[model samples]
Target: MYIDASLFMGMHAAVPGTRQACASFFAEHLRDRVWMTYEEVGRCDDVVWALPRDTQDAYYPFMDVLHSTMPVKRVPYTEDAWKTAADLPGRGVLSLRERLLMATVIASDSRLVTVNPRLLNLADQGLPVAAPENSDGRHGAFPEPLAGLYRTSLALEIDHARI
Candidate 1:
């Protein structure tokens, strides 16, 4: 499943109220497969920088855990993913970062797991796309990761004809 940055940074936004929903969301959806986009990494880092730097730098410890211990996968953005994101009909409606994350989700063949209403709109319009088997090109295993970007070379129909 694709994860939104909010699920990460919001859990420790240096604000208790912000974390309540994020914590609840995670506790309720424990078993879903999860991945984070490069955009999300930057967003999380943004949160880290915003925190008051104490003697121990509390956020780094959490970032270290995210970078290592979490079962979450790190998916990089590639040309194909960019193209997919750029071509989205709803591109006008989404924030630049959200578009990238959604593109990564589609390219990686995972359902977006977000509490973001904008992305949920795509789900409502039928996202969580998988490759088509009939050779419109998305018919096989993904290509090897190019540079930092992961396997999304296989052409995919991003679930909704409208999106």
Candidate 2:
């Protein structure tokens, strides 16, 4: 599954129970290989660096621990994914990064785990999207046929005609 930046941000924002929720979610799901777009990585960095010095100092070490323990594979934005992003439904509502992240998950044949309501709504449009575990230890419903991990890497297709 592709992890959204919001989940990572939640780990350090000090929201009530959010840190524990995100941590538990990561601890359970990140046991296997997971996917993350490079954009999400950058977004996480930017958001973390913008926090107060004390938060930054604490969050960086936590991020380091996650990096050491979890197997997160960062994928680059591909041309095919970009095209799909441009054509995503509700394009007017999502920001460019959100669209690209959604498209990357689609092109890779992977599911997205996000808390964003707008992105979660895309599940109805045939895009595989789910939410992280809630405070009550309940997981969000994953859209059918996409609950399982399909690929280890981004599945980009090449068009010979375009070459």
Winner by lDDT: 2
Residue ranges of candidate 1 with Cα displaced over 4 Å: 13-18, 25-33, 129-163
Backbone clashes, each candidate? 0, 0
lDDT of 2 by residue, 45-125 (tens): 766565577656644555665666679998899998988887889868888888989988888888998766688899888
Question: How high a TM-score does candidate 2 get?
Answer: 0.76
On TM-score, the candidate that comes out on top is 2
Worst 10 residues of 1 by lDDT: 147-156
lDDT of 1 by residue, 76-135 (tens): 897778888886656678888778777777777767655455666776667873211122
- Every candidate's CA RMSD: 14.2, 12.3
What TM-scores do the predictions have?
Answer: 0.62, 0.76
Local distance difference test, candidate 1: 0.53
